[model samples]
Target: MTNRTRTPRTRYAQSLICLLFVWAVMGSNSALAELTIRITEGADAAIPVAVVPFSESEGIPSSDKISSIVQDDLAMSGEFRTLAPEKMLSLPSKRSEVYFRDWRLLGQRYVLVGALNRNGDRVEARYELFDVNREERIMGATAGASANNMRTLAHHISDKVYEAITGVPGAFSTKLAYVTRDSANGEPRYRLQVSDVDGKRAGIRLESKEPILSPAWSPDGRKLAYVSFETGRPVVFIHELASGNRTRIAEYRGLNSAPAWSDDGRSLLLTLSKDGNAEIYRIDIQSKNLKRLTNHWSIDTEAVWDHTGNGFFFTSDRSGGPQIYHKSSEDAEPRRITFGSRYNARARPDNDGKFVYYVHQRDRAFHIAKTDLESGEETVLTRSESDESPSVSPNGRMLIYATKQSGNSVLTVVSADGGDAYSLPASQGDVRDPAWSPILR
Candidate 1:
């Protein structure tokens, strides 16, 4: 894992530039485009889930919207499409109230029911998951939290159900940092935000008139690295949580952006166009020394380190159009990861090293997709007309991507396998360039 280093504060877009790049790379989205996820092969189909309304056992404040939070948590995973309350054939509160036939009619394979018991100063929650098809209880748990901790408890339940059904550790408890740009009357406003993986507890990490881009967390989740234009140009800076001090790590002449931390936090891999064209470079944090990793003249950027931290996956136009490529420190040759997508592709490595999530372009829009780096299988994760900048969670079970809804940019998290998917409604402005943080307690 990359150990994130703390540095100083700075700056950090919806640009139709991404759309132009999509068309220049892939011929068109209308043609049966090659998907990246299909490269990875079969993921257990998105679990058909039904989370029954939760029960309140205790006298906790009735104002705590716990159930709503849990639903958001599960719905964002993308591996399970939650059955809406309106679509559910039955809403069971207890095991006896659960009629397999009623749930079956709703096309649900798994069901969850929960209740909250009010503790003196805290609350206790008991939740259960049922394998409706098998007529058996799959799992159950009891959790306690203060009123303010309701969202955290909801995440816990989601993590449990996700692991039980997918056999992969759930990342629902993680956090997300993304950039939002609100443009009104040709004037642009930018904000950097940190939100729960389920879109809760969102706090403004920093805001500025200049754009703030690429919000990445330290491995320990105590700091951030991003590019800011506050100084009139793009500069990469590191921010420490303890002191709120920001350090400028990279400030080249032409372009200094797209910062990614190495697994050990010893170095940063980013894109620099100072050498005439956008290329990848690795910088040692301690020595302040930079080593040019890619010497390509055709735009090469968005370098993502693999799970081992010894290698990276990036996007490049060396093949004519943007495509995903893997480069390891041990090898001089860069290997191509995506073959089907022509328009555009960005590599998002899973924590488990099983797959690489990416964006695939179709027609004139971009879609979130993933590929099995080993099997060469690909699957599409979203059907949205314009979606990009997918960020994988620390556990590799889910992804967060930027989407444009009603002409406004927003952040959406989805299970890596395409289970639950929903938008993180922007409280202040539009959102984009989401970067998921590694687990931080």
Candidate 2:
């Protein structure tokens, strides 16, 4: 056991790694269509803040409302309850115009005011955040983007205001990858799409009559790895976001599925059935070097990095039904981590490494749940009955997953602690395979 764990046998890993080149030879919204984000439920008590409609400086672009976008983004977080524009006592667009006593009387803690000015094909947003209690400007900044890129500018302002108030960087600027299935014509048509955190400016990445599954984002948020059956069988592919170019990364006899990225963005943890039964393997992205991570005979897949580069959490049926297990190192003995259920898989560790979330089965329904790494306590985070594909946001404050509602698949997001929740249902089809992008700066 000591030797086996220390030395991972190459098996056919070398040849498979060499196959890197074998396949290498082959490969917004409005301005993107955006996701409609609606808060189905909220926390028992949320922070009270007010976002005043910006004073349009005449030449500003005619597009989505900037202040409204930021307000919606903050409200969708389930952390802040924003006062409606109609309820604002004043339409102050600067710090001096803000009257703290008026906001205090409205029970608001923070106030955001801004103005938009057009510059050629671009717009400059000068925004200020004020502390109602202290009667002072707490945060102020200016952001410029093409007039057509108002959405991005709004999101940036939202991130700044959110960070200034909560001290935790907001994930409003991050992207999301999800798969949409449309069977309108008769046959199922799947599309891999990228969209904003609020589901706006959705740009399609891959479209196929076949199925696409498990979209995984790289650490840098530049590429996505997923399984596509467009080639008649399941093959793993890595696609560049900027160019829409892809290289077939894995193709074996049985299964080439479940692609997960390491922290360094240099390799992927995948499950391949070339040898017979399902097992886990790590593949270097550039060199195509392959290292076997699990040698078990049972089905083992869906392994995710621990961020510390120590080991990973995976699912296996070695104990009977699928269960979650943690490996200390490449060859270390596997220890079972999910004891509360006979079925738990798809472990997603937060950046802080404090909690791990996965698809959990309890009683008879499936829901997204997380386990406290230090305390061994499990908390179910969603009320959705048919949930799967759990992806955590960059800051680990929230997570998105796929679930079925009224017989249609929809994406649902909830706070990490299961406080407030929202759902994103496609306007025409079923959406699944949600992957949250890493924080990009």
Predicted model with the maximum TM-score: 2
Per-residue lDDT of model 2, residues 82-104, tens digit only: 99888877899998898888999
lDDT per residue, candidate 1, 1-441, as tens digits? 122311110010112224322322221112111101101112356567888878776566766466666665565555566778888776676787888988888888989987788878788888888998899998988888887687777787777888888787677677777765555454555667776775656667676767777778888888899988888777899988668799899999777877888877878888886755677899887887988888764567888788888888888877878899888662568988888768657678887688988889877778988888779998988877888788887776667787766664566666566754556645445557788877666
TM-score of each: 0.78, 0.91
Best by lDDT: 2
In the order shown, the candidates' Cα RMSDs to the true structure are 9.0, 6.5
Model 2, residue 24: distance off in Å is 26
Q: Could you tell me the lDDT of residue 112 within candidate 1?
A: 90
- By summed lDDT, which 10 consecutive residues of candidate 2 come out lowest? 24-33
**Candidate 1, position 228, lDDT:** 85
